[model samples]
Target chain A: MQPKSVAVVGAAETTRLGKIPDVSVIGLHADAALNAMKDAGLKPSDIDGVATAGISPVELAHYLGITPTYADGTSVGGCSFMLHVRHAAAAINAGLCKTVLITHGESGRSRVGAGGFGRAPSSLMGQFEMPYGVTSPPTMFTIPVLRYMKTHGVTEEDLATVAVIQREWAARNPRASFKDPITVDDVLNSPMIAWPFRMLMCCLVTDGGGALILTSAERAKDFPQKPVYILGTGESVETPMVSQMEDFNSSKAFRVSGKKAFDEAGIQHADVDHLMIYDAFAHLPLYGLEDLGFVKPGEAKDFIRERNTAIGGKLPMNTNGGGLSYMHSGMYGMYALQESVRQMRGTAAAQVEGAKISVSHGVGGMFAASGTVIFTNEK
Target chain B: MARLLPEPTPETRHFWEGCRDGELRLQRCTDCTHSYFPPRAFCPKCGSRDVEIYAASGKATLYSYVINHRPRPDMGTEPHSIAVVELAEGPRMMTNIVGCPQTPEALILDMPVQVRFDKQTDDISLPLFEPAKG
Candidate 1:
């Protein structure tokens, strides 16, 4: 269903980003939820719908004293928040709920009240992938990158350029965890976590949370802040294990979700003034740009190396420093959405000047799932 | 410290049993003629239940890989290559590359390889890969 009338009326990150050892996983959710409620000039009693990932919606609603008419807990992975936005829009358009709040919280760095995730030995991954020593995301995610590099003729230097460009974007934002400029040499020289992935190429681990409130476009104007209209949204999932991805060179989910969003938005690629591709690792943005049709396959590395996605570039992407240099609290989709809203509202820390349209895309579980959202301030 | 071990279930018992007996077994679909790894009840390609387990040719080609430097409690401090190999019968499986240096220079993509079992426990034997010998 086309949710033409749904819009983001409220958006806010937790008061403090980066490191917060004091806040539990649920506490981070409440902090961001409370901040977003204040941003929308709404109270807990005003919310009738709740959606969240990482943490359950039931816990969020009960903690915030909200009894919702509808609730959605679509936890695919980091991109779960993007899926939540899509689901919330559909729910609102269907008259399932009037006001909806979507939240995300992760204690990735602190590990306080954080949930433990692992595959059972009896599970498919445990029996197949894990037995050979594929344990964490850093290792599992690299399974495809080597193939991608070999097929595309992408060198280690080209991969380093991905980190360098994002770090350039990160240097402009104060809230970014690592603002210091890093060179391609620095990225290559950084300690190796997995082959083809160095320390600088990976995302930062921090503790933070973000939330958004959505309502019908008719009532969005009544809110204090400008409403970022949800022009289009799409989400899709592939396999549970990263090893089972249909193609090693590309993410099928990213292609499906992004194409659907672009088709629904009815906008050309040039119309996107801002873009956010979840940068959990350097290779992701490369895959995202190609899979989303912004650049041709085996060409994103050159697109980035030429400064096409950098600060002065035609397409300002990951302007919030991205998860690479910014605060990645495990589930980074919410932060990407927050930056898109901020760019549309003309209030971002590293604002892309005169930005009207923004496309926020996210990946969950090492390209296992994807969600794409197209937002615009033209109401 | 020893790394995590696989605990075979009723469905995967045959696969483990084959490995312990020095054979690489996989499932083949009667309807679609599709061969696959990781024991399952139905054929993943055609969704056919007419699947049977048989000893594979034990030949594969290196598809992709990474040399992990980070030391796990069980994996020791030295770097090792975690690789995916496409079997001759037409399915890829994750395994460690043995009988070769775990470096990008040595682990060539699409190179011919064969499976070798390393018995992790009395009942479990993990399948690994090595350069194919003439």
Candidate 2:
């Protein structure tokens, strides 16, 4: 599909983030979906197509009472919503669906009617990595950072610095789960979950979700909210196991997906007015910067340390505090995408002044999958 | 229940069986000559069905790892390294670094190591590694 052929007419997150122990997983999806629908000035009858990662599109349609010609249930990882937008744009261009609703909801903390992170013993991860005592995101997702740090001459202080910088952005946003500024020493002093990664370096375990509404650019003017044009989008997958990543220093999937989106958008890295690389772990943005060509390999740590990507830097990144200080609902891609949309619409809680371009990137399942979505306020 | 072992399928049964017999086996595509781990029927690179299995040198080097503070139920309270080692033959697989301190100074990246088998059950033997003998 051509860039700007489709646009995001609506975007909203669950009414209450952080801890919603009272709400079930599906209930969270519904709450976000209704809010997005209202933001778009539409109802169930106006939504002819549906997409989701939290649950099956069939189930979302059944619950939302939308009967459509197009339904997408692409679940690679947290970036599933980004892929849904990419696919929805293509589906809309092909006349498969007029308007698509992409939803993501996870009771990450509450676990109310939610599935726990358990791999079946017969599955590949259960068979290979699990038996070795590797468990949880802290154990598996963090497996590659040691080599990355060693090769780049990065100190443990560099990792903690990421959390510190993100909290600076978080302190500005009232919706952020963690608003208090933390020092690198505070981060280093936090409890250790894995070597080179303290508790502060890890993402928050909160219960929340968000949704998006997409339609043709022609119909975008009808929406109540400003349109966030889908300028470029890309998605790809690599090995499911973190151990099998092509390189210990960079994510091959992130490189592939980020390049595809940048190429499709026909924009250089310098054109990105704002950015969001999924910070599930503090080290991820380091990998993202290098792999996404925003910085050279082994230089992202210093780039971050020099405050290049921090608040008031040349590249205003993760202004919503990211998954580190912001609310992380297991799948963090949705929140990252929401922040990008907010930046483009000039409504972010910690808004970047006059921001026009934003790139949102995400990784799923210990670097197993990645997706990138480039949005622009201008058509 | 926490000693999560892989229930080998037909595609990967030989790998588990080789471990049971004190062998570290790897599959290589005869077409592309690319060696890979966690054995499969076809080459991941060239997607060729023509492949062969061979006993690796049982030699490897530490590629990457994380010293997991949270140990598995079967493992004692002490931290252990969940590591990926690059085989001398050119494939990487997940394993534990045994017979060495699971500390940053000791578990250095690129350190030479040799594979050893720990027979877990009648049907399973885990491939573990220790510092290579000089």
Candidate 3:
């Protein structure tokens, strides 16, 4: 409830990202957790609280030999880590635990010790959607985008511009997976995975993980890394089926989640010097821009086309190139959170110049869940 | 390879049976008079247990869709359209667009459509949609 009561003291991704075939899912978790622990100069014994998605918090604690007083396993999908960060901040503020470690990892491409993405025969999605030939994220996550485009009169070129601009940002970061400059024509002319969606519009399916360490703001200075204060946080969930989203043009979950964080932080859109709207697909950031109040409805496409979110733009977004050109190991929220911290710490690969505030927002499932976390370097 | 079929629960069994009988059934809340799908015992809105199963008009408008080019083992070689159609009663459900080519040019948004049942098994019949006949 109290802003700036908590801060991220340490944050790190696995030692190497993008195609870590040898690392199992749990191994990636441990890799990121240990990396973050080392970054904070803390040991496994120092963590009194633990939280994660995919693997249970209990499993993470037992695997890392931590005896935690608080643990959370709130699995909502890719954005689950954002919720973990929010919950950990609350737990630390309540004095439930001294230090908290939040972790994420997915064997999305490698499938090493990875579980299948099957649902029960009687599950809601299984019953209604699966029979309709909805096979993967490309098919399901993209269900509503066409309607949004049709209503707004957005063109395929506008959609291609999203990937083009993100690739421009990707060219600046050394950690990016695809650093080559791509044109809108390149994106439009690429292989079509689904109608209105090309290969470039979808996120990369790589193998990677990231972690964050949270503690009381009072103790934040003791850590080795710059203290990235948790300025505000909010999260919400909507319908399970993509078809059931209240509106196709805008995400109710994104609106509710983003507005809560902004209201809680007591900041305006202009206050955010850096932003990372989860780009599991290109359309997400478009929806995010409008729903988060950064742009008016139907203006997001133009905002992006005019290059406001591109490199050297007024608002430098997804500086790590986002999930579009960056490494997306299934759950992309952790990576989004990591970039925010990097910007706030002033050590990002493509750091925004003197950025003081950063907002990281994410979606889970197909517009079904959302989480927003605001960070500031100002204490 | 077989397409995934529904294993109906008591709460949702009527929906499947309605499709098998060539009817698009939905649950409507009596208290609020709100209609909905993917059957639940209590009304989603107002949480009223006072609900009834009723046959819908089967008329809908094409709300949105994607033609998945990524082939699934269960789905055939031809690209298929996965769509969500808003029914005449206001509820939306996921279904396939049939009786037309699965292309962006052919399957226009907001086009009027009517429901058609594709019987999968004796118990599980799918409610697909096609362009409204003139």
Off by over 4 Å in 1: none
Best by TM-score: 3
The lDDT of model 3 is: 0.92
| Candidate 2 local lDDT, A1-379, one digit each (tens) | 5999999998999999999999999989999999999999999899988998867889888988989889888888888888999999999999998999999899999998897778887778878888898878898899888888889888889999999999999999999999998999999999878887789999999999899999999999888899999999988899999998889899999999999999999999999999999999999999999989999999998999999888889998899999999899989999999999999999998889988899999998899999999999998
DockQ for each candidate? 0.75, 0.80, 0.89
- Order of candidates by lDDT, top first? 3, 2, 1
TM-score, candidate 2, is 0.98
Indicate whether candidate 1 or candidate 2 has the larger lDDT: 2
DockQ, cand. 3: 0.89
lDDT per residue (tens digit) for residues B1-134 in model 2: 44677788888889899999999889999998999977789999999999999989999999988887878776778888999999999988899999988898899899999999998899999999999998
Flag clash pairs in model 3.
Answer: none
**Candidate 2 Cα RMSD after full superposition onto the native fold (Å):** 1.0
Sorted on TM-score, best first, the list reads: 3, 2, 1
Per lDDT, the best of the predicted structures is 3
Docking class of 1: medium
Candidate 1 lDDT, A8-35, residue by residue in tens:
9899999999889999999999999999
Q: Is candidate 1 or 3 superior in DockQ?
A: 3
Candidate 1, residues B1-134: lDDT per residue as tens digits? Answer: 67788888888899999999899999999999988867888899999999999999999999998888985667877899888888999888888999988888889999999999998788888889999998
**What are the runs in model 3 whose C-alpha is more than 4 Å off?**
none
Query: Per-residue lDDT tens digits of candidate 3, residues B1-134?
Result: 88878888888889998999999999999999999887999999999999999999999999999988887888889888999999999999999999999898999999999999998887888999999999
